[model samples]
Target: MDVDLPYRLELISDLPGHDERAWQVAWNPTKPLLASCSADKSVRMYSYRPSDHGSKSLAFSHMGTIPTGHTKTVRSIAWAPSGKTLATGSFDSNVGIWEREDVSDSEDAGETAGDWECMTLLEGHETECKSVGYSSSGTLLASCSRDKTVWIWEVKPDADFECMGVLMEHSQDVKCVAWHPSEEILASASYDDTIKLYIDDPSEDWFCFSTLSGHKSTVWSLSWSPQGSYLASSSDDLTIRIWKRVEEHEWKSVLELRGHERSIYSISWGVGKGASENLGWLTTTGGDGKINVWEITEMQHTKDPLSATLIARISGAHDVNDVNSVSWCPRLEHPDLLATAGDDGSVKVWRVVPS
Candidate 1:
C-alpha cells in the first residue's frame, strides 16, 4: 500500500451469499441493487443504502437469490438498460431472460421484492455462452459463446426475441461482448487475441466493421468510456489497451497500460467523481488478485494522446484469490463506489477515498 497515493480503496462490506467462485458482478443502472453470478449456478441480489455511520459508506443487505436453473455454471450476467430485466448466460449453452413477478412497489426505492422468473430461454449457441449484454436503448441484446460466434437479438414485446444476426467472425472462443455506452455498435473479445466491432446494416444484417488486432494473447474483456469515444480492453497478456476512434469506422490503439503481472480478466469504465466531466475512471482486476484504478482524461486536441494516470491500486484484493470481476456503481450520486467478485466466493464493496 503506497501511502502517498492520491486515492485509496476503503473496505465497505463483504457480501456473503454465493457458495462458489463468483464470476461477475453488475450494478443496476437505474436502481440501488447489485447482482452477482457464480459457478454455484445461482445469482445473488443485494440492496444497498447510504450508511448511517458515515457519509462515504454504504450498507448492503442480501435481498434474494435466483437459482437460475442453469445445468452448468452461470458465466455472465447483465442488467438491461431499463434495469427491469436481467440476462444470464451460462455454460449450459443457453441465455435466460428474467423478470420479477411481483409488481407491488416495483417503483420503490429499495430492493425489488418479487419472485424472479425466467421469461424466455434463448438457445442457438452450440457451446457455452460466455457473455451477454444489452444495448444503450434496451432494444438490442448481444451474446457470445465458446462456439466462436456472437449473436444479436432484437428485444421484442412480451418477452419475445428475434435473432437479428449470427456473427461467425471470431476464429476461437468468444470471451466477452459489450455494447457502446450510447450507440448500437457492439464489441466482442475473443481467445484469438482480437476484438471485433459490429454494427447493423440497414439493408442487411449486423456485420463486423472493424477488427482490432494487437494483443499478443487472449482478449478477455471490453468497456467503453462514459462518452463512447474510447474503448478499453484487458487481456491475458497482462496489459490494458486503449483504442481511440480516429475515424468514423476506424479505431487505433493509442495507449497500452501495464501493471498486472498476470492475466487481466475484467475492466470497467465509469464517470468518475473527478473535477472534469471528461475524466473517466477505469477499474481492472484479474488473476493477480489485485485491483487497479486509473484516471483517464480525454484529449484536449484530436492529435493529443489520451492521458492515463494510476490513481490507486490494492494488491491481493481478494486475499490470495483471483479477482474475477470489478464493476463501478452506475449511480451518479455514488460515483466512487465499486463492487468486486472473487474466486473466494465473496463479493466486496469498496469506495475510493482521498488519502
Candidate 2:
C-alpha cells in the first residue's frame, strides 16, 4: 500500500462520449484494456500504450465495441477476469453479457480487431438494474435491482447459464452487490438503509448471516475486503462504514470513515496479494468533489472506529462535479494505481505514490 501521501491526479487522457454522465468504467485484469459506459447508450474500450506515439489517435487503443441495448441509459459494466466477456446493467431493467470473438486477428497479443455480440440477455430484475459483478471464479454472476432483491446465476462450463437463486431480504431497492474473493458469501447494500450478507444454499433457504447497520442514510455502495474478512460501505449519509466478521455469522462495525461531507457515490478496495490483502487498502469518491484513501487498521477495526486516521485525501477533485465511481485497477501487479470517473463525463487515473 502507498504511504500517507496525497495522490496527484494526472490527466492521462480524456474520453468524452456521454453527454450527461459516464456511469461506469471497467479495466480489464489481463491487459491495459479499459472499458467505459455511459448514458449516451455506448460502451467503448480504450487501449493506451505508453510506447505508442501520437496526440489524437495513437494514445488510445479502441478495442471491441460494446453494442448498447438498453432503451433508457447504460448504468453499469463489469469485465470478467478472463477479459473476454463483459456484463452490463442499465436503466432499461435489462442485464446483457457481451462476449468478444476474434474476427480478423492481424497478429500479436496487443492486436485485437474483434466485434462483441450480446450472447446472453438475463431477464429477472423488475426495475432498473443498478449493479452487476462476476464472481471470484467468474462462474457466478450476481445483479441487484430496484426491486429489493439480489439475483445470482450459475454460468455453466458449456458457456450457457442457469438461474441459481434470488436473495430476498432488503426492504428497498438493492443498490449494490459484491461477492467475497474466496467464498460464495454475498453482501448487498440497499436504499433500505441496511446492508445484508447472504450465503448460497441448495435447499433454497438463503438467510441473512449478518445485518450491518450504521449509515444514517441510504447505503449506495458495498465492497468486500479482498480477503473476505472486512467489509466497506459508502452512503448518502456522507460517511463510509467498515465491518468485520469476528466470528462466523456475527459481524461488527469497526470503522466509520468520515471525510466526505456529501453523499458518497462509490467505493473500491486496493489490490493486494491474498484474500487478506486483496483489498487491505481502500479508496472512495463523493458528491463533495473529494477523493480519500484509507488504511484499514487493526486498532480501528476493534469496535471503536472513530479513532482511525485518514491516510490520504484529494479535495476539489472533479471541481463542481459529483464523483460517480472509484476503482482499483485489476492489472494489479502495480498495486498503487486507481481509476476514477465522474459526472463531468471524464475519467482520470491516479498513481498512489508510496512515500
Candidate 3:
C-alpha cells in the first residue's frame, strides 16, 4: 500500500453468492440496494447500511436472488431512476424487466419486503443483448445487442413497452448503451470501434446525429459525466477517451487516458466527493485486473477543455480475475462508495479513503 497516494480503495465486503462469472453490477439511485448479474443466469441483490452514524464504512447483506429465467447468461443489469424497476439483458437474446410486488398487508402496520418477480420480458434482438439503460426521466429504455442494432422503447404504464425505433447504423456488434444524465440523448458504443449519438427529433423519428470514431479497436463501454457535458469511453485499444460536447449535436475527443495494460471493460463517471464543483470522478477497470480512479477537472480559459489526474490505482483488484464491471453509488451522500463485479463470480464493495 502506498501511503503517499491521495486516495486508496478500502474493501468493505466481498459478496460471493454468484455461481458463475459476474457480468455487471448496478447501484440503486434512490435506495440502499445493489444488484449484480452473472453468467449463471441469476441476479443477486444486496442491501447496505452504514456501520455507525456518519460512518464511511457500510455493512452489506444479501437481500435476495432472482433466477432471472433466462436460458443464457445475464450480460447486463440497470436500474431505473426511481429504483422501482430493474432491466436485465441476457445472452438469450431477450431483455427482462423485474420489479418487487408489494405484498405487505395493510393491517400489519409494518411494511414487509416483497419477492422480486419478472414482470415483463422484451424480445426482439436476433442475438445476445449486451446492455440496457433507462433514460433520465425514466420514460424510455434503450437496449443494444450483438445483432448490430440498438432498440429504443417507450416505457408505458403497467409494464408495457412500445418499440420507439430500431437503430441499425452500427456496422458491428453494439456493446453498450448509455443515456445522458439529464437529457434524452443516447450514446451507443460498438465493436466497430466507433460511438454513435442519437436523439429523437420531434418532427421526425430517432436518428443518429453524430458518429464518433477514434478508438483503434472495439469500444467496450460508455459513461457520461455527472452533468452530461462529457462522455468517456473505454476500448479494446487499452485506452479511455473523453469526448466533450462542443456544438449542440457534435462531440469531439478532448483527452485520452492511458493506464490499463489490457482492454478496459467498464468505466463509470460519478459525482464522487467533488460534486460541489460539478467536476465528477471517473473510475475504470478491465481485463488487466486493475481498478483506477481519476479526478476529472474542467479547464477554463485554456485550449484544453479538461484534464484527468490519476488519484488511486488498485492492481489485481480481483486477485488476477478480470474485473467485468465497476459502478459508483448514485446517492450523493455516499459518493465515495463503489461496487465491482469480477470474473471470479464475486461482487465487492469498496470505499475511497484518504491516504
Per residue, candidate 3 scores C-alpha lDDT tens digits across 99-137 of 888844342211247888998999999999999999999
Question: Scored by Cα lDDT, where does model 2 land?
Answer: 0.76
TM-score of 1: 0.97
Query: What pairs collide in candidate 2?
Result: 47-61, 227-275
lDDT of 3 at 9: 90
Off by over 4 Å in 3: 52-54, 103-112
Candidate 1: count the clashes. Answer: 0
Which has the higher lDDT value, candidate number 2 or candidate number 3?
A: 3
Q: For each candidate, what is the lDDT?
A: 0.93, 0.76, 0.92
Residue pairs in candidate 1 whose N, alpha carbon or C atoms collide under 3 angstroms: none
- Between prediction 1 and prediction 3, which has the larger TM-score? 1
From the highest TM-score down, the ranking of the candidates is: 1, 3, 2
Once model 3 is optimally superposed onto the true structure by TM-score, how far is the C-alpha of residue 272 displaced, in angstroms? Answer: 1.4
